[model samples]
Target: MKNNLTSQQMGKIKNLFADRVRFNKVERLVYSHDMGMMPEQVRALIQCTPDAIVQPISTQEVINIIKIAQEEKIPIVPRGAGSAGFGGSVPAKAGIVIDFVRMNKIIDIDKEDMTATVESGVVWQNLEGELSKRGLTLRTYPSSSDSTVGGWVAQGGNGYGGYEYGDFRQNIVSVDVVLPTGELKSFSGSEIDKVYSLCGITGLM
Candidate 1:
């Protein structure tokens, strides 16, 4: 596979993410696809191989990456646990794949408000376990418990228990996103629709 990123661009990314940046061909290939199994014809047409994979552990680091992507005019693909088998996390044009695994953290749990402030990279099963300890549980979650919160939100928030409670959108209080222009903004209520199920086109959550 061809290396789409120049050395200088790679260096800049390295400076931001240090050892978290992955430029190896094999690693890029692994990050290129998700749980989805595409046919060879489709894969060939889409060029699923990503140029690079980066793991950003914080919102500020995500902002920095967006800035570099904007300056270099490269496609930025945000990814979580890659549990969805719908090509949502696959790279179509071979650019940077922003893996959010490192950002997984349960920031807070507000039992009074029945809300949890967590990083997008957090897995549903892990969250559920924590909630169970407090005699609480998620109203809805994907069938694949390993799926990340960000992935579920990006895919329209539909999952198990949605019929009884509601979709993920209804459960969200707010979301912090880094826009394509490298601007960090928070969305809530009706404004959340702007980025929900957008597949990371508008921003990185």
Candidate 2:
């Protein structure tokens, strides 16, 4: 793996994320793969190893990261739990890997509406436990209990409850996303179709 970020750019990221940034080769290598095993030929062709790994605790931090990546023309790969085996979380090129683990806060749960508002890093199992305490549970969830809500949503949302409740999209109410251009926007209803399963191409949810 090669270091693609300049010293000044690294400083800017350090300023934003403080001690949450990882630059060591070992650490970056850990982020290069997900649950799935890629073929040797494919692995040999791509630079899966990231230049750096950063954990952001808020949406604003994600926006700032996007700004920096845009300015430097670097690839930004968003990751959550790294439970998916489809290689969506891994970087195809060496760049920044934004790990959302630190953002795993359940913002709100509307009991009456049967809806939950959470950060992208919210793990499904944790959310299920919280909901169970309130005498509620998710209608559908991924087979991987450790999968993040945002990850599952981004990966096409078909899982344990697909037979009854359908895919996650049918249950989605809305989403707040930071677009590639650093614009924050909310989408719901039919508009959500634009952002679902886009793998962060359209925006970061």
Q: What is the TM-score of each candidate against the true structure?
A: 0.96, 0.97
lDDT string for model 1 (1-205, tens) is 8988999999999999899999998898798778888888898888688888999999999999989998999888999888878888999888899999988999999999999999999999999999999999998898889989988778876789999988888888999988888899999999999999888888888
User: How does each model score on lDDT?
Assistant: 0.89, 0.90
Per-residue lDDT tens digits for candidate 2, residues 105-190, read: 99999999999999989999999999999999999998898988888767776888789999999989999999999999999999
Inter-residue clash pairs, candidate 2: none
lDDT of model 1 at position 106? 99
How far residue 59's Cα lies from its native spot in candidate 2, in Å, is 0.7
How far in Å is the alpha carbon of 53 misplaced in model 1?
0.4
Best by TM-score: 2
lDDT of 1 at 100: 94
For model 1 the TM-score comes to 0.96
In model 2, which regions exceed 4 Å deviation? none
The regions of model 1 sitting more than 4 angstroms off are: none
